[model samples]
Target: MPATPGAFLGGVVVSCAVVGAFEAGARPGGSAWPARARRTELCRARQRAGSGSAEPCNPFIEENELTDVGLGGLMKPLKRLLSALTGPIPVTRSRAIGVSERLSAVTTLTASLEYLNQRKQTQPGGLNHWPTARGVHGRSTPVTRKLLDIISEEKTTLTLHAARAVVSAGMLLPGSSRWRGAGNIFLGATTAALHPRHRYGTDGSDQVSILVQTATGLARFSARPQTQDALMWYVALQANASYFVSGWVKLMGKAWKDATALGGVMRTKTYGHQPIYELTQKYPRVAKYLTHGVLALECFFPVVYLAGGRLARPMIASAATFHLANGLVMGLGRFVTAFTSMHPMVAYTSAPRTHPSVAGRDDRVLQVGAVLLAGAASVAGVVAVQRRMRALEGWPHSRWLTTRHGNQLQYEMSEGDDESLPVLVFVTGLVSTSEHFGWITEKVARDSGYGVVTYARAGYAGSRRRSASSYHLAESVDDLVDLVRGVVPEGRTVVLVGHSLGGELARRAAVALGERLHSIIYLDSSHPGELNRSHQQSEATERIADGMNTLVRSLNVGLGILMAQPDWLEELPANCRTRVFAQYTDARFWAAGRREWAAVEEEFRAFDGKLPVVDSHALVISAQQTIDRDPEQLLMHNEIAEAHRGQGHSVEKVVLEGADHDSLLTGARFATEVGRRIIEFLDQAESHATSRVCVVEEVGQ
Candidate 1:
């Protein structure tokens, strides 16, 4: 009977898994035979040393002896146990030969077409601007530079064109001589080797696909059956090694262990795709689980391939799914086709083979039990560590209010006995937690004797993740509304204070609040037009956020211990400072901040050229230091103020001298003055409202 493609894929997956499991379970030098051989060598050396020769004892053997009693005896049974589990099954040479030709042809042809498509999509000009090419131009010898340029340009063009022609010819004439395919394969491989850097100009995956196609072509053209088998095995081993090593290397990183690295990658233009990026933003736990899943699958890929039979099929299916998802979400078009081409080699190599050992059926059961035990222990350890960390770092003075959608929103409030005083709500800027307003929140509450509110947005510190369906701006506004209404007493108006992107949200809230809105105070607030003008600036911010998240996750403990208390934090109480530092070092805080920044553009567009219409006076406080540093930003601030003034609302514009954007809130020299000005504005607004009420009452009488 002829073998199906599905069966071939299954065989490949099983082979990979078995090989991986074998590698994990049986370390090369740890087996009894190898250990005994080492011991024998050591005894000879000791005898030589006694006869006046100088030789050092094996450190590994010494360490093993110290760690375990009768190390060789203990490992012997375990080694035997693994061998029984991994014992090969019977497969005929006829079956192996039957699949090899078909599988190789399919893999080669698919890879070739994919490579051609990649070249078309990423035009030749793109290769010229790659970092590797630029480096070559700067550092390479004149002759080397010319050779590289020729290889990058002429060779790439000729190889791609030739490969495309061969694929097209093969499709039209399936029985064409193998010599033609071999020639095309040689041309492609030579081109890639000449300037390996150029192959990855647009996507690294393309290089893998091109190389696989060349290898397959060579194997198919080879007259010797042994040579063909060797070539197939080589491709299969390389693929398995790539997955295993990639997974192992990622495991070494603290970012991957904590599952925060994916979030950082998603924030970059190169790797971030909106669908998957937003999915991770909405459900960070999903990203965490996905990180673990990818690592496990890659690490165990060799085991799946080695397992053969039904096991290989599921592994192959899973690998396909992974590549497909990555291709669509990350725009890595070449990965889907490139990696899939290697599947044939995996299938061919994984076919069942007869072994002389008569492994008992009971040994299979023992192998299953051993695998389950190991898997269980790994899961339990991971859970225990995560739970311990979470328990150790509990939130302080945390209060949660359930929104209409049943999501919990966290906020901190300070109130005075005065009911007539307007409630002051402070909204923070992009990537900022409520702790950012600690000093300002304290100063305002202390001096004014009025109620003040500071709350974290969704996915931020102490706040639960928002509903998946909720848009960033609407969700933010809804959460703010809930927090205010839940906390503030009835019949009292509220003042909205916003900083940076928070200021933009305040403007949107002002429009929504209508009669309930008291006034708005903008502190170095983001202008509506700013988003349109700051593409490069936004990219830089994303990069900074990525770096911060990585640093925080990788050194959470070290940073917590080493971080010095900033001068601005001194204004906060001791307990508050500790809480602030804790939040600063958290991966969640950084991830939430990145999501907030990512949504800035969409949030800015939600206004549709409409300004907030508030009956109360509006205050615009621009930092003079920021103005001097960026004249364009100052002009934007001025334009925003003038636009408000033109709208017939009572708008006041003030520039705080010697204060930069952040210094307006944090600097000791300017914070007091900034607070005073804010209080004065609030008091004046209240006075004006009272006078208007008195005049209206007199007219009515």
Candidate 2:
């Protein structure tokens, strides 16, 4: 008979499986036949009819039988492998039907009850007004506001319906196979729907636990009587895969491997129990051992399962005990129930099967192919979604302007029609994007009625990189001058506002601008003397910067999801906070920040003893509550103020009490005060300029 398509595929799959097994089993060793012959000779000698021998061996036993010495050892492993590849899969017979049904009922009831309790405590007032209740209202953009509200509603409704369906179906008709299938289907759908909302939840890992349970439930429902064991085995394999992946990922992190992460987590008030926290603190070595033990168990879970029988039972018990301990220590009661529900199924599936062949090898080949295809599709889907999200969030759409050096700079401008008002030109500190001044810029533009502009320097944010030779202070000043001249209206006077290292660039630009400058305001700005003093970069600082750059680039996506808005930004709309956070996680932002740190010493030294002879008014706003505030820094500010006065230019100094350097720009009270001070200075400067023009005209007449 000619071979069919199914047979051909089966032949190909079996060939691949055999080759893979051989590759895995091959190792450097003596001849297999010689080792078997030696073992057989020893066994035969021991089995010989000796005068005082207590143990007996049957003459009918073959030489190969001697190799299977330890508790069904080598032969059992070989049989299990053959079974997995081509033998009949174990099924739940009539006697085993009630076991799965009972387990499913208990899991459904426990999950439903716990979910209801969680909803009462965490969600409050159900789905109605949930977005506003969760403090998600009044977003800066309407689209984001609507999207957040919709997602919240969908998640709440899906979870509620799915939990209710599973509970009702499992409890009312536990014996009914159709109802069991219905419950599993609903639970699986719910798990799929909740995947995207995991990050939004307080316990993301809890959601993952529930997802595993859902998979086990679905596997039980869809599997046929004969193939059910195979499906269950696959689910157990998934559980082991999860543990191994999580354990290995943690091992990659230094803190987790060193046990510090375990200690830190235990000490947290929200997630930690009092007993565990106290115990970990009192006995640090215990914490270290516990951490290492968890890593070992999780990483070796699959090995234990493969060993089967007595070896597997202890490890399985340990996993259950570990979950129970977590429940007690971290108040993760749901995880205990959710994960424990799957344990019995995993245990049952992991046991050695004894059954004759019922299905052809072609079925096994198709099953393996389907699993591989599904896994590949899942990975591709995740990559596609991530790329789509990045595109939708405007990460790729950079606002560009050609600089004097032909480099494109990214920038943002606040819309305003008030040409009469002085144009507020903002320069951000090193490594920061134009969006760093988001809240302050919006407030200033609205309150002061000034056209505001902020731009990312070359190689920062979304801007194109500059030539290596153009990274110095002079090149930066030239870029700033061109940006302001091109963006600002021709007749409008410019008010320069510089924050941190931006102050250095502002001072340099002010000198180059000469008469076009209306006034300069420094908000907790860096002084020339401070820069010259700290010109030589310390190795420690350099190491810290390098670490930050690496971390930001590698974990940018995760950082974007988990970042909380600063306390100062609490009053801004939620969408504004989201936008600011997205910019913070941009790889270009970190790269540019590192460059700024690298060039700062040289840039500062280049401008040593060269202070701009400012004919325009100057205002210095200093933060009083800076943690690293030096006495010399205060003296530098004072000296700069005195020098402006000495030059016969109007100088004003405003000290903000209880405000840190960042808070000076973002804090609600401080930002409002800063805005008021800037308005007052601009008004006075405008008045003086008007008077001087009138006097000059009168003298000429």
**Each model's total of backbone clashes:** 27, 1
List the candidate 2 regions with Cα displacement exceeding 4 Å. Answer: 1-108, 111-176, 185-254, 295-318, 342-425, 429-432, 435-459, 462-686, 689-701
Candidate 2 lDDT, 1-701, residue by residue in tens? 11223332332343234223322331222113223445656667876746376656543255446455776665766754543333111223321223333333433444444444445433554433364353545543787556555655745655664665466345334254545555655655554443333223324333443554454455456545546555445545666767786676666566677887777787777775567777878898988999899998887776654532324445666776786577556655444444544554454454443211212211252378478968766665564345334422443444567777876776767646677878888888765546556667767777767778787777664567656563666677788898888777788888788888887688778877877787778777776656555433232354446465554545443433334555645644455565555456555556667666667755555655645555666788778864245555666666555555534356777677777778676666677777777777677766664323110001000
For each candidate in turn, the TM-score is 0.44, 0.51
Give a tens-digit lDDT track for model 1, residues 1-701.
11123433433453344334333332243213334555767767777768464555664555466556677778857866754444322222222222322333333343444445555433545553443454646556888666666555645655755664465335223243566446446544543554344434434444564556566567557766556566656666777878897887677666788888778777777767666677887899999999898898888887754543324545655776787667556655445545765655564455443221111111232355468868766665564345335423446655788886566777777676587888888888876657666666767877886788888777666777757674476678777877788887888788888888787778777666766777778888888766555554444553565565555454333333334556566654455665666566555666666666656656554446545434555677888876676666766665555544423245677778877777777665576776777787777667664333211000000
By summed lDDT, which 10 consecutive residues of candidate 2 come out lowest? 692-701
| Model 1 ranges with Cα > 4 A deviation | 1-398, 535-545, 548-574, 603-615, 646-649, 689-701
Report lDDT per candidate: 0.60, 0.57
